[model samples]
Target chain A: MSEELKALDVAVEVDARGTACPGPLLEAKRAIADCPDGGVMCILSSDEGTIIDVQRWSKKMKHEYLGDYEDDGYWRVFMKKTA
Target chain B: MSEEKPNLEEMIKQLTARVDELEENAPGDNLSLGVISGDLDYTIATFIIALGAAAYDMQVDLFFTFWAIASLRDPKKKVKKDFLGKMFGAMLPASSKKLPLSKMQMMGMGPPMIRSVMKMHKAKSLEELMKEAAEFGVRIHVCTMSMDVMGIKKEELIDYPHMDFVGVGSFVDMFQNSKQCWFM
Candidate 1:
């Protein structure tokens, strides 16, 4: 999964590190508005809730949640704006 | 003989109609929030949940009553009021920024400490969350009866984009139509 995401073309990358709960998710929602449909978006977050929050947000918005990868102290959550 | 025996097609038709009715009666993608506390922590939590739900594509309504109404007061706006109204205004928190924390309030030290922590974590402040909530189309309803009891005038409230002065009955109607109800 990490290898797949690494090769995927991400149109937008939101850096939400050091933000608290729901902050990263909110950032992703705002950034995804500019991302074209079917474009992959990446969110870098250090919050612990980002992993599940992104997945749930993606599902609710009818987007495709590509999953997350841990790097150093932060995480990279990926999603496709299919909706 | 036909009158005595139940027809399969007719039974299926009846069941389908019943299912349709059930589906129509189910609650929709809406959330009703009862905000009764004026404490900074509770107020923040209320907006966080409301904003999150709004982002999830849910129609969100926040009904502010009693103490929570103080959080909506505009600090910069001054209005003519009776003695009682002035007293109430002086007693309650001036605005969201002036609200106290619910616990560990050591002579008003807790709020600032928590605020700094929030800033350090890059969490949106209460004002920012409220603005974002309005931007997300979250409806804010202030309780008419509570406002009357507290001697708060509509002009004294913040100029939120989607705010309205409403009665408890209106909130009840909203609550009944919502898929979920939260009391904070």
Candidate 2:
């Protein structure tokens, strides 16, 4: 929420809008995997099933899922990196 | 400090040489992953890609977008053709819906009928298969924007372990770091 907090953390953003099913989510996972410890990756999507799929994915990966958000007709998913 | 060690320097050199040998033979860390992004044009493609990646022991992620997101929908949707046609085409509607996607190998009736047969045989449904794949560590994602366009609700989706929702910009960032990216 605060810039200071953000400064102390690394973040990666993945844009998966209209990309297609599975393709985008798979990309997001690979991104999160490459991130350094204590980093977070955010994914943007336009798929309806993501609400369930991405949440389940983050859970399995043992990453922190910050829920989903809508931004100018796009979805924003924030994932915190862990190992 | 031993009173007198027998060839302490020689022993140290031998140990160091062995350590160096082990380090040289040890594998290094290099994790590579591939990503796919497409709609229905990607259903079969995504599955094949996942199977291959899983075989190679590479971590895979399938992010569903738009029509493709429906790929993760209820396997019941698999037999969809509306009430008019599907009713006549199906014997046991519920089982027909649970057939395996890959087993539906009919020429015109190939994929559909194979699914029907798989359903009759009590094969694992798409959701079940995807769940098992996730247990193997596959990550499946869906898009929220498509949800709005399709007028679908999240609660309608199945609860699976390898699923998630994200944004486009986020995917772009993912692309920057991925070893490989596929349009399927």
Candidate 3:
């Protein structure tokens, strides 16, 4: 947990690994709400589709996409809630 | 004699006016779904589409009629009914969770097998998709006439927020206003 926090500088971490497709994306959306304005949220997902989905969702929702990193069989995506 | 060049200012003004008029008269971007199948695959498909559209920022209206209304029933709720109605209710799956696949049911083993496979593949289950759809503000509507004909009471359905019990006319109005409509 500390490693992830250090790696992403995220205020909130959503563990959506093992969830499929829209599940991870939905979790990211929900987690972003808990983040303060301009605060970063990190989503950990194993689903391959989430990479593009989160990116698209971030763009559509006007969030700042901080990019993603692959770690230990999962992808960690970072986004800052702009709205 | 050479013809005079078209007036750029006048053409721009006319085009802008036409754009404004189209925007004013554009129908609401809504997706209306006529869900008429109670099979597990169909129910899952309905919710998947609804959730996908809702996530994409499109307003979604799902009208559950005929056999499809069975997918919204609460398994724990038991409604008293006449003998025939009781038999009918008993024959149908109690809730979305109990819905069987349209094909290869294999005496009810297929659904559980498929669900396990979905889980293994990290796919969202029907129940999970339904919850997501609700969170995304998808409007779920139950056909009142179908409920009455099937001897199902309001209490027998899951109490989703903003769920509506309406007649065919209400569904028609929604269909007419929707930019895209599907009967599945």
Q: What do the candidate models score in CA lDDT, each in turn?
A: 0.85, 0.56, 0.79
Tell me the spans in candidate 1 whose CA falls farther than 4 Å from its real position: A1-83, B1-17
Q: Highest DockQ, which number?
A: 2
Q: What is the TM-score of chain A alone in each candidate?
A: 0.95, 0.79, 0.87
Model 3, residue B160: displacement in angstroms? 0.6
lDDT of 2 at B134: 70
lDDT of 3 by residue, B82-184 (tens): 9877887888778988988889999999999999999999989999988888889999877765776687778888878858766554565577668999988
Models sorted by lDDT, best on top: 1, 3, 2
Give candidate 3's iRMS in Å, 1 decimal.
15.4
Q: What stretches of model 2 exceed 4 Å from their correct place?
A: A1-83, B1-42, B75-110, B114-128
The prediction achieving the highest lDDT against the true structure is 1
Docking class of 3: incorrect
DockQ of candidate model 2? 0.19
DockQ of each: 0.01, 0.19, 0.01
- Candidate scoring better on lDDT of 2 and 3: 3
- Residue A62, candidate 1: Cα error in Å is 34
Q: How close to the true structure is residue B163 of candidate 1, measured as C-alpha lDDT? A: 83
**lDDT (tens digit, per residue) of candidate 3 on A1-83:** 54654566568889998765456777876777689998888889775446555665666567887777778987887888897
How far residue B134's Cα lies from its native spot in candidate 1, in Å, is 0.5
